[model samples]
Target: MNNFYKNYSGIILLLGGIILGSIAGLVFGKDVVALKPIGDIFLNLLFTAVIPLVFFSVASAIAGISKTNKLSRMMGIMVIVFLATVLISAFLTIMAVRLFPIHEQLQALKITEKIEDKPLADQLTQLFTTDEFYQLLSRRSMLAMIIFSVLIGFATLRAREKASGFVRFLNEGNEVFKHVFILIMKLGPIGLGAYFAYQVGVFGPQLFGAYAKSLGLYYGFGIFYFFALFSVYAFVAGGIRGFKRYWANNIIPSATAIGTCSSIANIPANLNAAKKIGVPDYITNVTIPLGATLHKDGSSISSIVKMAVVFALFGRDFNSADAILLALGMTVLVSIVEGGIPNGGYVGELLFISAYGFPPEALPPAMIIGTLVDPLATLLNSTGDTVAAMLVARFSEGKNWMDVKEAA
Candidate 1:
């Protein structure tokens, strides 16, 4: 019993948090505002760990790459897999919308918003960073840090003897920071409990009913995407036995993704899951982190569903050939930008309106749909990450790689 409880504690705590929090919120209403500090503290700790972890982990992974050719091969394969998963996901979402049409009135949920326009040149500069060290300090610049860290890793590799100590320091720092992050995660239940409660209190029933048609369609198709699409990816990587093994091994990451609703927060769990599924440490380290930032099948599909809903609300024709192509394109762009942006998926829906030239009135409904499906979006994103890592292992390592000891 103790061992069983230990094994399932995170899931237990998460469910307990959501249930009790929801109850408390419904019972206490606005008074639930008192619980915000508890959730805030936990979220702040998570945000604190994100930048250091991404920097050290990715840099160490890249620096450790012995053959530069292999890095390119791995990246090339990974990008192909990521794009395939996303495009297929978007296609499925479109089919789902066509199969079960959503019809509902958009509630007037008043919310003000703005998206800052950074030109292509500036975006490129920010991605690599003109001042690498300064941009690393900026919490918002994850892409910049990733680019800078990879460059540093390559530099360290070229100057191995001279940079050995620095690389060692980075590896050691990664271990230390990872341990600290785990320590912080020990408080996840308390933090998530309060946070879940606040969410329920603030937007539970009202939001659900307001966007029920779209939310229902999003989740319904989301389930199909998760089980059906993931199974296909697993089967492609490994046959029947391998497919079963992957799913069994994926429990931790799956639960973590659903509970946290943030792929970044789900990385540690994904790492463990990757190892259980027989991906080597080297590949897992690089692929999972990169996947967290890039593999966003969930957001791609959800973006389409949100667009369809917003279009329907405006009596706009979403079935037009131009709209279909626009959604496909926007899905890719949005998935790329979704990482590390605060409330990014919600804000990303604005692009749907802007892309289709919809009236400004469509923004509120888009926000509503996006916010409601955010958790499932994270699940799809993180789930795809774990699968992508396994696929990388299969391509780079071999099929026999995953047939080893099952993931605990």
Candidate 2:
């Protein structure tokens, strides 16, 4: 019972809050719009705090990596595998949204108009870098800030002992912001509750149907990815034997991912499973730990789905080739900086809205979908790391990695 409560408490509170807010809307009708300020206050707090939160967390996540680990063959292969799987998962989700149509098809949003006036090359340049550093300090240029943070991390890596104190500062800052985020989330039950009340009041209940439909698509595809996609990854790593070995040892890790809803939490299980599946310790140690934060097929899917839902809600054309490509790339980045902390998906959602120039109202629904889809998403996310370890081992240790382990 204690474990159950500990694992499920957040979902319960969030759901309870939404339920209460929805009730208030049904009962109070348009008068519930009075609660809009309360919701705004919550959004304001999140937006204000998230800028530093992202900078510090992302910088530190990168800074903590050992320089030796940064230059290895294992790192390169792991990165390729991560990107490949993320692209596959993201494209899958995009296709699913098209075939099923989770929300009512609507016209493109105003942002699409802006996209037409700007040249593609110029827009790409601006997305990656800012004209000035001060611009990165704002959420409007999140991609720039992330790029800068990554550079800082790499720079710190190069500085070695000379930058020890600064490295400590980055790590400490990451911890501080994590706690700060926790404090902010204490208001979630109330804040999100009020926001939902405002949503139901102002937007009508039709949006709820969209939420239900999207959530269903996410869960359905998540399960398929877990069972089918993972099998294929394992098969690539070790052929028929590797496929059998993967299923033999992966159940506990998969279970932990679902139960905890955290990739970080599933690390030990992944490590143990990888060892059993004969991944070299060198490969297991790096991929599982890095994959906890960096490699996330599940979050990739979630990000694509979140982007589509936001587009649909705003009457935007999600099917545009440019939008699809941008969404695919953003999924990879979102998977990179998505902290392994509680409510971390909030940062990713914030990045989505800001990157696309969506108004603040789009945030709540994305966040709610994240909450609803988290369990299965984490399952795909955490287990994929172990599978990635298999791929890395296959590359690093040769095609007969499993046989080599037995022979050794």
Highest-scoring model, TM-score = 2
Going through the candidates in order, what is the number of backbone clashes in each?
A: 0, 0
Q: lDDT by residue for model 1 over 313-394, one digit each (tens)? A: 5555678775687678678756754553223464345444544445444544554456567778888898789888878877
**Clash number for candidate 1:** 0
lDDT of each: 0.70, 0.84
In candidate 2, what are the lDDT values of residues 1-408, reduced to their tens digit?
787678768877988999999888878878998898998899989888888888887888777876674447778888899999999999989988888887655333222223232455765776788999899988878899999998998899889889999999999988898888888888998999998888887667776777888888898888888899999999999999999999999999988887777888889999999999999888888889999988889889889888888888787778888788889889988888788654567788988788777778888889899888888878888899999999989988899899888887
* TM-score of every candidate: 0.59, 0.95
Off by over 4 Å in 1: 1-67, 103-210, 340-342, 403-408
Query: What is candidate 1's CA lDDT for residue 191?
Result: 72
User: Positional deviation of 72 in candidate 2, in angstroms?
Assistant: 0.9
Error of 1 at 331 (Å): 0.7
lDDT of 1: 0.70
Which candidate comes out best when scored by lDDT?
2
Residue 184 lDDT, candidate 2, scale 0-100: 87
